[model samples]
Target chain A: MFSQRLSMALPYAILFAIAAWFFYLAGQFRFTPRGDNIGPDFWPRLALGAMMAICLVQGVRLVLTGRDDEPGLTEGFAAEDGAAPRSSLLLAAGVTLTLAYGALVTVLGFLIATFAFMVLFSYAGHLRAHRTIWLSSALGAGLIVILFQKVVYVSLPRGIPPFSHLTDLFLGLF
Target chain B: MDTLLQLGHGLLVCLQPFNLSMLMIGIALGMLVGVLPGLTLVMGVILVLPFTYQMDVASGIILLTAMYVAGTYGGAFTAILFGIPGEPIDVPLLWDGYKMARAGQPAEALGWTLIAAGGGGIISAIIMVALTEPLAEVALKFSSPEYFAVILFGLASVVALAQSSLANALISLCLGLVIATVGTDTTYGTSRFTFGLPILEDGIEFLVVMVGAYGVGEVLARLERGYAGAPVTQTATARTELPSWRQFAAIKWTFIRSTLLGNIIGIIPGAGATVASFVSYGVEGQVGRRKAQLGTGIPEGIVAPQSAATASVGGAMIPLFAIGIPGSGATAVILGAFMLKGIQPGPQVLLHSGELIYAIFASVFLGIFIMCVLGYFAIRPLVRILDFPEAVVSSFVMVFCFIGAFSIRSSVVDLWLMIAFGLVGYLFDRLRFPIAPLVLGVILGPLAEESFLNTMISFGNDWTVFFTRPISGTLMALTCLALVLPLLGALRHWLWPHDFEETPHSQGSP
Candidate 1:
């Protein structure tokens, strides 16, 4: 019972703490008021204050009612084909792979990073077709590179030496 | 007379080969996005934003606007034939649309959707073209105080109309406002929330926030669900059979009411097609002639929501074009696109870029026509996109999200920021905080601050000036009303629970 209540109350608690931190930081905004001009901290402080008050009220309501007052604005908008089986492990893997891709894109170039991310993420999403995964990922990555780089003229990251060479070679073909 | 002449010229511009092709491609891609359960219309529009970067501004806006227009209608096929709402806007269609299909009238249901979408969209486009100039003229008279009040009203409306707890929405909005406050202050040049990193000074782009939250965030949410909700079954006969004129005449009032309601909702900042669709259906329940038979495979049930959803695209464009305030998520991205091209949309845009404005207006009219034609002939191919594995589609979506973020400033920092926001988006979803308010806050926060600060500085820091000016005062009052009404409704619900028993088939998980 205690754990359940803690779990329910935790989101509000974290929100309150974050809002409080921002409010404090707002106080430290280094702005000297010139004439009638307000400081830069003014808007943020007002927003943060409102946030804190809202968190407090919501936290109290949660404790007293022991339930959310209403459904989320988007609560009932998911698929209606009944509940799907959830996999925490797959979610973790997806998040980890996405974050790793983001971190390594500059290091490994958009081509290599995107290709690897696509294959791994597809697998994480439960696709077991090995040939399809590799082929699609490679083709998808190649098409996107050409489309964005050559067609659209976006200067995509070319990465370090070997990967850079591969990207140039790929670019050279078209 | 002048508007007509300009519109004629605009049509000529739209008919140009390149612009025409963009419109066609945009509509087709939008339909595909709307048909695919994995891709939301806004995400699809965002994914397409980078490609528009190199195009002429007119072609670029046309592409996004065309997608926005078609997206509202494209989801109806899946919703009617398969019981899967391709977009949140189509959720309302599932009740009567799917039921009608189950009752062996899939073609009839799709017919109502096409007529409703086509009719409502064209009417709203007319209204948009007619009203935008006058609205922008009136907006030209607005000062900082009035602008601030309008922005506040928009923000408050988003919170009030939130189907969730008001407090959570408010918190989400406040968090977005805080996020917008990161980096250097525009007025004072003071670094804020930057933690001493050079990358932090330029501030977080709203595109990054949008792509991360709406794009990556959605993928993560679906991944957690293990992509469990594919369409139950496919229908062999998925073609649309448009309603006869006699059938359309019978429910003409439904079309009018829903179209007007959608345009109004679309004109209001913060509300979009989904709200317009849901609210129109609810209104139909209250006032529709066949109200009692709304969800029982009735034409009124399908027409009301589909019309309003499609019409909202035009309605949404009005505020975006006239006042420089985005009326929906998609329009906000359009606003970002306009800013990217160094073109601020407002009264000045009407004055200097009138031809471009008319070109966009023409595209809407032409795009709606093409959308209906395509919807009539291309139902089979569009529905076939569902055959692709969810895992594969999601992977491609992730790559698009990354490319979109990276190309914004070509900075790797933005990619990381996008991932971080993806997490925030997922958390918001899990926690039930609405994402719209957060996004709108980020987009409008700076405007709200600048306007408010300018008002304060202009009036010697007397904040009451906002309440003293007539227009600002009225807007402020409206903002208060928007905020309070939901609470009052909740209070009533709390006091009288049985009276507010959940409306059946009214709310769907989009």
Candidate 2:
């Protein structure tokens, strides 16, 4: 019961704070309504008010009635019936790679960047064999570039760092 | 004849060497994604959406729809071999199919399941093609008021049928509604929660929310469980490689019956494939199996649920084409793609672009036919992988969950948002909250709100319009009935005697 109190109520309070902060920020919107009745602020304010009211009610309800999900304190995190850490780490790594790849796509160039990304993921991340990673990555990059550039005519950047001669070559020829 | 001619054009587009290859690749990718635990059809679609941006309209859509069909079929592989279902829709299938596998007829179960699924898909696809035109005509009559009623009906059905406590499901819905309000107020064109983060201008993308809720949340839940893979058993039996015609014949009626049931149920928004699959499976069990024979591995039992589950693809598309309103989570993503393509998928499109609609209809049939042919040959090898240790697969699922969340809109903000929802999802899971209602709430919340506001503006804020409009009025009454009838039933059962409630399994008693 005590842990449940900390787990649920803490988030509720923090979320309320965040909501109020957002409401204040919404007030900064440039107000313009040439003819419409409700100004730009109208909906934002309404949302803020409704959110505050609901959150207030939720907080009050939790205080009045404790959560029924009382965990057995004796159950350690590992021994608890559920939980896998490797998946979380891998997922975190995947998110990092996606962001990095997106950020670096222009700089690294599409072909070079995407090839590196795939190779890294297949090898270091997924633990695929080196040869398999190289082959798959090369194939994946080649296919994507061919489809986007030659067929659909969607232009990806020849890329920023110009590390990829292949992308430059493709973009030049196509 | 005109529609058929349009499809001829679509075929020309689809039959392009690159487009055909992409479709095949997408189907394979869909199967791999679906085979993984924790990753859903929606995840597969979200992850692949970015790749399709470079494609033309027809090819892009062909790839996505192919993924949808293939993903649904892919889940049965996991369900049949291992007791663990890859998707919630396959849960009932796991109960019987796994039992059959355990009984040393893994091949038989796999073979029969493929037949049932293919059979159901083909039947429902035909029905969808036949019904799309008439259904579109009906959809043309709907206005904001009618949409408002339909949305309410949809929401209420979710609450009525969701797992866990009704209060919990309602709470999740409320939470979703709250989240849906976070972005700019579309009506007023003002930021609601930007907090100086430019990303908040769009609020949060629904794809991000879905990926976070299902993907990140699944990882968190798996981590909490300390789960490793289940032990692999011997590879499938010879019975699977050569399923007898008689076995196929025996389950043929059940396959058709479940397909019909799935199609009918899927037309109702909020009542998605999971419900259709489970209900069909249970109904078949009650009718076809003796009480004593229920738990044992019966080939017919596997057929009934698997067929019905896949049939939902055709059935679910009915409302999508008819009214432009999506019927389930995956369909919601399809709707999003339509919006991205500048195509509003409602009656106007049906009237003006009937050719395109028919092309899509034709593609659904052809897509299933292709998936069946491909899956039949691949299932033998795919089924053997059921014996792969769960830990590796589980970890892989976790990784995809994270990546899937991040890929939506390619924003780091969504990653944070996803983690936040993952925590929320975990809390909900612990407290017996129904995830589906929350998901449905998020999917349809904006539409519900917009329609309500629009109807108010049109009628001078008169609530009476909801009751006065012809289509809307009936729909409103039905929404009320959907909510009230279930409560009344529970009340009657409570006030009187009910042996069903006495059972321990009725812990999820609504």
Candidate 3:
């Protein structure tokens, strides 16, 4: 029962803490000494104050209402999951791939990084059909590269070797 | 008469091959995204935004507008045939739409949706064209104080009307405003929240926030669910079958009432198609002669929400073009598009970029026509497209998201920013915070700050100047009303909790 209550109270607590932190940050904002001047900090400070007040009220409401009320907004999606721990694991894996993809895109260039990311993402997504995975990933990456680099004229990272040469060749077609 | 002539000229612009192709492609993509669950029209617009960056402003706006128009109608196909709402806005259609399909009138249900979408869309487009010019004329007389008041009113209305708790909405909105303050202060020339990063000096790009939150974040949320919504099971197929002339005539009043309601709701900031569709459904349930028969596979049920949903598109565009305020998430992205093109939509937009404005208006009509045609012929193919695994779809969305993030400044950091926002967005989504206010905050925050500072400086720091000028005063009063009404409603709910049992809390979750 205490755990249940904690689950309900946690979201609001976090929100309140974040708001308080923002308020502290707002306080750190340097204000110019001009008389009657609302400095650059005015809007952020005002917004942070309002957020803190709202977060306080929300937290108070959760404590008073207890667990009988509908769960806090963040709680519903968790209950809907079939296996929460597994879902979290999957999400973690997805995020890791995403981060790795972001970090590696410039080094591995657009082509190799995207293809590898696509395959890993598909495999993570549990798509078992190897052909579908490779084909769709290839098509998606090719189309994106062409659309962005060729048509849209945005420069993509060219990587360190053969991949860079291919990216150059792709760009040359335009 | 002058409007007619200008509309004709706008028609000429839209007829250019490139513009026409963009419109068609936008419609096809819109329909595809609309039928797929977990993909929203706003996400569709955001994902497509990177491509638009390379095009002339006209083709880009035209493409996105076409998608916006078609998107409202595309979700209906899934709702009516599959009993699954492709998006939140399509939720209302499942009541009667699915019932009609299960009753073996799938074709008829689809036809009603098409008719309602087409008729209501055309009517709203006509009204949008007629209203925007006059509204802009009235707005042309306004100055900084009035602009600040109106923008404040916009922000307030969005926060107050959010289907979630007003507190959550405010928190989300304040978060956006704070994020908007991260760059060098244009007025004071000092950075407040940059924390000394060179990238922070330029400010966070609204597109990064938009694409990350709506696109990557949405994919992450769906991933958390393991893409666990009910799978599409039924494979029964039929062509769209139109009702008889008498049958169509029977539902004329439903169409008219829903269209008007949709337009009005659409024009209100923060109230977009989902609200319009649900409210139209509710109003129809309460009114009309056949109201008692609404939920049991009735034509009125299908007509009312579908028409209003499509009509809301026109309603959303009015504020966007007239006052440069985005009335919905999709319009907010379009606002980003306009700004990217170096066009600030307002009264001045109509004065200086009349051709582009009218061209967009013209595209709306043409889009509605093309959507109906494509929707008729492409239903079978779209259903096949939906059969693609959810994992694959999420993967595809992630790819586009990465590309979109990278294309922005070709900065690897933007990609990280997008992924970070995606996680934040996913958390926010789970937390039931309305993301719209956050996105709008990022877009409108700078403008609001600029306008407020300008007013303060011009008026010698007198705060009352906002309430002194007649137009600004009236707008300020309205903003107060907008904020107070919801608080009063919340107060009532708190005071009379027993009376509010089973009260449906609308989620502006998208």
Using Cα atoms, each model's DockQ against the true complex is 0.68, 0.13, 0.43
Write down the TM-score of every candidate: 0.96, 0.78, 0.94
Tens digit of lDDT per residue, candidate 3, span B152-235? 989998987775677878888988998888888887678777777888888898888998999988887777656766667655
TM-score of 1: 0.96
How do the candidates rank by TM-score, highest first? 1, 3, 2
Pairs with backbone N, CA or C atoms under 3 Å apart (clashes), candidate 3: none
True contacts kept of each: 0.76, 0.09, 0.45
* Residue B111 shift from truth in candidate 2, angstroms: 2.0
Residue B52 displacement (Å), model 3: 0.8
**What TM-score does chain A of each model score against the native chain A?**
0.91, 0.70, 0.80
**What ordering of candidates by DockQ runs from best to worst?**
1, 3, 2
Candidate 1, residue A145: lDDT: 96
Give the per-residue lDDT digits (tens) of candidate 2, residues B376-419.
Answer: 77765665655443434443443344444444555556656765
iRMSD computed for candidate 2:
8.0
Q: Give the top-scoring candidate (DockQ).
A: 1
